[model samples]
Target: MNVYLGLGTNLGDKEQNLCRAVQKIEERIGKIVSLSAFYATAPWGFQSDNSFLNAAVCVETSLPPYEVLKETQQIERRMGRNYKSVGGQYKDRVIDIDLLLFGDIVMNEADLVLPHPLMTERRFVMEPLAEIAPDLVHPVLGQTMKELNA
Candidate 1:
């Protein structure tokens, strides 16, 4: 299965964190097929001091969605993520990895959401995604990146 992932870092060594994340991802998960260019953007949730360094990765993975998610969380922790604040989305330290899409699969579970609930709205995600696969369609919305960006 080919999957799209969102990567972001706002705390400490943003660029290195993202780069190391890519390496770790390719090391743990299946091979990385495509990777979007690095993008600098403002923090999305709670106002923060550091702007986020963001990018997207497309990888070929045979792992199931939940297992993939679990592995990603583990990677985040290995990179120094602290999941202390159990609540609505907020910024955190080190690397933040989100499983955006799992080969067009639509899932709305307590722990995961496929095609990323806010992927379309955020230019940070959309821009990088468009950079790599502008023709990629939203499985549920039936809209391509070009269509959505237009």
Candidate 2:
């Protein structure tokens, strides 16, 4: 399966954090097919003095969506992230790995959501995603990444 992931960090060595996360993803998940340039962005939902350095990645993996989520979460935990933003409460962290898309699958389980619910609305995600997968379409929105980014 081809999956898209959004990586961001507003704490510690931002560049190294992203690099390590990408490396771990390749080692534990799958080969990285595409990676966007790192982008500097502000905190999205919560106020923070730290600004985030964000990027997007496309990986080809044999693992199912749920497994992908589990691995990504584990990656975050191993990298010093204490908790995920819950109930729309965001925070600065050492690393955040969001599973943006899992092929064309649309799912709404309590733990995972494919074609990430807020991906299109966030420039931090769409800009990098559009960079690497301009023509990739959102299964739920029926719009290409390029279009969404615009």
Q: Which candidate should be chosen as best, given lDDT against the real structure? A: 2
* Cα-based RMSD of candidate 1: 1.4
In candidate 1, which residue pairs clash?
Answer: none
Residue-pair clashes per candidate: 0, 0
> Whole-model lDDT, candidate 1?
0.86
Across residues 1-150, which tens digit of lDDT does each residue of candidate 2 receive? 899999999999999999999999999899999999999998998999999999999999999998899899999999999798889988889999999999999999888878799998899999999999999989998999999888
Clash pairs for candidate 2: none
Q: What local lDDT score does residue 103 receive in model 1, on the 0 to 100 scale?
A: 90
Candidate 1 per-residue C-alpha lDDT over 37-104 given as tens digits, one digit per residue, 9 for 90 to 100: 89999988678888999999998998999888888988999999968335766865688898887898
RMSD of every prediction = 1.4, 0.6
Model 2 shows how many backbone clashes? 0
What TM-score would you give candidate 1 relative to the actual structure?
0.94
How does model 2 fare in lDDT?
0.94
